[model samples]
Target: MPETTRILLVEDHPLIRAGCRRLLAQRRNFDLQEADRGLAALELNKRHRPDILLLDLDLPDGNGLDLMPQLVADNAPVRIIILSMYGDSGRVSRALAKGAKGYVTKNDDPAAILTAIDKVLEGEVYLGQTVAQALALTQLQPETPGLAELGEREKAILDGLGDGKSLAEIAADLGVTYKTVANAAGLLKSKLRIRTSAALVKFAVERKSA
Candidate 1:
C-alpha cells in the first residue's frame, strides 16, 4: 500500500458526506477528496487517480452502479467500495459483479466501514454484515427452476425489481423506453408463472439473494 492512501468519496448529500469526512479523518494517512455528482467524481478520479473510491448508488445525474464499471475500467488498480443505502441483494450482487472490491451500506457501523476500507485496500473483498447475511440466507432456500429458465434481459428486469426500482427507473437505467421495460416485466412474470406483481417480486428477491 502507498504511504498516503488517496480516497475519492462520491456522495451527493452534504450531511452524509460530512459524516464520512469525519470518519475518514480518523486515518491520518488518508488523502480524501469529495464530489457530489457522478461526472465530477469521474473528473476528480481522472485527475488524482485515488487508491480507493467510496461511491454512492443514487446520484442526481446517474445511478452509481452505471458509473461503477466505467470507473473500475478507467482506474484499473483502484479499489471501489459502494457505500449506499440500498442493501438489497440485487444491488449488492450487481455492484460486486461489476468489479467493486467491497459493498458497505450506509447503515453499517462506522467501524465496519473503516474495516472495509482497510480490507479492500489490502486486496480482500469486504461485505457489510447485513449484506453478507442476506447472501447467506439465500443458501437456505431451495433453488427455483424459474431462475434457470430466465434469459439475460429477463434476469435484468427481475434484478431491478428485486432492488425495489420502479419500471421507469429501471428503464432509465437500462436506457430503454418505459413501455419496453413494462413489456419485459410482463414477459418475466409470464415465464416465471407468477400471477401477481408481489409474487414476482418475491421470486426475484429470492433468486437474486440466492
Candidate 2:
C-alpha cells in the first residue's frame, strides 16, 4: 500500500483554503490540515508535523518566507510547495532558495498542484515550465532586475522604460509593435496604480531596491 501523504494547507483566503482542502481531500491518500495565518501555521506545524506544506506567499501577520526556516526545523522531511498567484521568476527563485520543494502558480490547473505535490513527495523539485524558463533566464543574466509579480514581457518593457528610452525605441528593440508596448505599459500602470511614467519608474526602482 502507498503511504498517506499528509498536507498542511496554509492560506489566508477562506474560500481558496476551503476549496483547496476539498479538492485535496478528493484524493484517497491525502491527510490534510488547515491554517489561515503564518502564526497559526507555525503552531500547527509544531503540533501536527504534517508530511507536506502547501504555503501561500502572503499571510496576514507576515510573509510566508519567515516561517519556512521554522517549518524546516519542525519537520525536515516535510515537502513545501509554494502556492501563489504570482508566476514571476523572482518570487519563485526566492521561495526555492528558502527551501520550497515546489513552486506552482495558482493559475495552474488543480492537476498541476496535485502533480507538484506528488513529485515533491518523491523528492524532486517541481517548477512549472514558465517559472523554470524564467529561472533559467535569471541564472543566465543575474544583473537584470527580477520581478515577483510582473510577467516576463512586462518586466522587459518596464526595464526598458526605466532607462528613459522612448516607447517607440523600446518597441523597435523588442521587435514588438508600438501599440503592444503601450498596452503593456497601460497594464502595468493599472496593476501598479501609477498615474505617470515617473511614478512607474519610481515604483520599479523601489522594487529593485527591495
Best by TM-score: 1
lDDT of 2 by residue, 71-172 (tens): 999888788999887767657867888999998777777777888888987889998765776677656764423345779789878767765677898899
Q: At residue 54, give the lDDT of candidate 2.
A: 93
The TM-scores, one per candidate, come to 0.84, 0.67
- What is the C-alpha lDDT profile of model 1 across 33-101, one tens digit per residue? 999999999998888999999999999999998898778778888899999987777778889988889
Candidate 2: segments with Cα more than 4 A from true spot: 136-210
| Global lDDT scores for all candidate models | 0.87, 0.81
**Candidate 2, position 164, lDDT:** 65
Model 2's number of clashes is: 0
For model 1, the superposed segments whose C-alpha errors exceed 4 Å read: 160-187, 196-210
Lowest-lDDT window of 10 residues in candidate 1? 138-147
